[model samples]
Target: MKEDKRPILVFGATGRQGGAVAEALLKARWPVRAIVRDIAAPKSVALRQAGAELVEGSFADLDTFRAGMDSAHGVFSVLPANLSETEEVRIGCGIADLAAESGVAHLVYSSGASSGDTPTGIARFDAKPRIEAHIRWLPVTATIIRPMIFMDMLINPAFGLSEGRYTFFLRPDQSMQLIAVEDIGKFVAAIFADGIRFSGRTIKIASDTVTGRQLGEIFSEAAGRPVIYSRFADEVLAANSDLGQLAAILDNGPLADHVDLAAMREINPEIISFRAWLATQRHQAFDALIGSDRTSHSA
Candidate 1:
């Protein structure tokens, strides 16, 4: 197979979504240039070893953005959501602006699933749409992807996984969409490969849909012990404003995740279901979480 000579500059290459995109792009034979704050960091070094050309840069530095975008054919843009909303918007829009000025052929921005059409009134949810709008006005050809809740979040110990139960934003009967971190990369690579098909398009992507009850069943089966699933207790949500708003969003707002799973699978057939993903990548974690609390009664 002929190699793709044009390089794609990847931001946040040391982080989850961006790292996945870089790996997927490399697997697809696309040359990848990753911008990192620390060239000697283990993650950055691993990326370099995996064939990414690392360029030291920071989001606060416009010169680094220009240097990375220089001679690049495409860019995978992702920003850490924990940053102040102003900072997030600035860095996100700045990357898009630079990519356009540099004449990059394609730019893909990774936004959140809850962002679109209307504001969710939450800072994190609201920030992406602002970035999305900025990318649209630019002269560059761009694709925006709104990825659903990450499946990996299910295994988090904070979610009561250490107590033989799972607590999340969804009610027992409420179904929500989720995607694996690895699949995010696949979708981005596909978007970069056929920009004509995905350009100017803002699509939501997910691998599977499951209800809170279904999640319990899957967890139980995976751990070989019954695990209960429940929504965050009323007091829990009431106390933490961010958690409360997020739970409310999952209940009735945009975070409900209305992704077309079949079409997403058609685009990338290897997208793993929640059960399959748990079985493969998260089996040991699941085992450990369950094994850690042997005295906890099953729900």
Candidate 2:
């Protein structure tokens, strides 16, 4: 089969989500052009080594972004969450506008789980909706993907996994959708490969739904011990208003994953469940954070 040499301009290719998309696109035989702050940076160098064309740039510089879009077939846009909400909105909207102006055939924006039709009352949640609305008005073929909570986040030591307990937003009985970080790339690649199906669509994506109690059970299995799972305590939420707001959103229902898993599987057959992701990433020593007794398993 012949490769599609027309380049897809990918923003933030040195980061997790963009890196996954770059890998997936390369595997699918599509050409990738990555925009990075430093072409000499190790991750950027790796992308170049892996057959991606790299453009050195920062999100703050619109001209650098435009350089990446030159003669591009498509654009994959995702702004890092660390930016101020206002800055995030500006960059996201600017990228969409540029994609339209550059005549890029398709633009896929990686939005957040909390963004939807109504205001989420959280600036971080609200930013993407603003960007999405701007994209809608533009003369561009754009698909908005609102990804669910990342499964990779669950193993972080800050979430209490290192203490043999995991605390999160949902109640033990309340279920939430989760997706592997790699799956986002798989879905994006498929959307790019399909000439028409995904244009002008706003999609919610997730791989599996698991209640908090089920999460406890899964962690117990992985760790070979009873790794307790519970919703963050009332006091914990009270002390951290930002965390509290997120929990409140989940409790109120706007933050829950509503995408159809069956329908999503049709789009990307490679989507893996949370359990599979855990198994595959064990080599990274997430097992240590989750209290997995590797010595016992070896014995």
Candidate 3:
């Protein structure tokens, strides 16, 4: 433990990205204060056990955010998108404004890979570019981390991968960038430690780039079984309007653009490749998708 005394306030503490950041901060011996809507939540308790100071607050409450930002050396902010435009934007901007107002030394805002000049016609993915632009003009030194589509999304319950055949947006030939949730924390922590060098920069964070066919091969090899990948059937997409729209964006849009691996490796030396991740993960959660005996579960 490096005994870094300055505390960093982490938003979305209960979720995957925030949880990873909190854990990484603690392991580095840096003081961490995580904002959670419910302190009683299992994830909150886990954060406390991992040495995070938990604060009960939602992104909607600016007072709570201000309090958390005060005396914080850095802030790690992530906003959840559940098809709600208002909450998502408010949360993302509020944290940036609060961090800037409080004079926090370093602020890291987690955005997504799909965010760019051209609109994807998806509100959630596009909202980030607005938030990123807002953060750029803030007074405090800031860094924007645009992570690629999460690898965890593939294992979600909604995709119906448990049926032996996996369906997604890409054709077998299309390549997509993705990142592991665990890698988010490691990369953010490293940035915090080297704040001077990373300040005022926007960087795309992706672990690996793989095609639809490659995913099938990786999954099949990891599971010791056969798993085939195919584009989402038109019928399935037609029936699910929301998924259909998203799949259209993924298939046609720049969401699957590749990242500069050499530069990313320079930032975080331990970035995990998708195949490496599959080999190391022995948990039963992932087994649902590729195991010999499958179960009925979503993601």
TM-score against native, each model: 0.93, 0.94, 0.89
lDDT of 1 by residue, 1-299 (tens): 25646899998899999999999999998999998999999999999999999989987776677988888989999998688888889889998999999999999999998886777778877899999999989999999998999998888888877677888888898999999999999999888888899989988889899999999988877777778898888998999988988888888778775777789988888999898888777666776777853332233
How many clashes in each candidate? 0, 0, 3
Candidate number of the best TM-score: 2
1-299: candidate 2 lDDT, tens digit per residue: 25545899998788989999999998988899998899898899999999999988877677778878989999999988788789998999989999999999999999988887777667878898889899999999989998888988877778787887888888999988888888999999999988599988989888888899988877776677878889988998999888888887787746664788999999988778777777666536575675436322320
Candidate 3, residues 30-107, lDDT tens digits: the string is: 899999999998888988988899888865567777888888999999887673666677778878888888999999
Q: Of models 2 and 3, which has the larger lDDT? A: 2
Of candidate 1, the 10-residue stretch with the lowest lDDT total is 290-299
Where does the lowest 10-residue lDDT sum fall in candidate 3?
Answer: 290-299
Of the candidates numbered 1 and 2, which has the greater TM-score value? 2
lDDT scores of the candidates, listed in order = 0.87, 0.85, 0.81
Residue 91's lDDT within candidate 3 is 75
Instruction: List clashing residue pairs in candidate 3.
Output: 156-299, 157-298, 157-299
TM-score winner, 1 or 3: 1
Model 1 misplaced stretches (Cα beyond 4 Å): 292-299
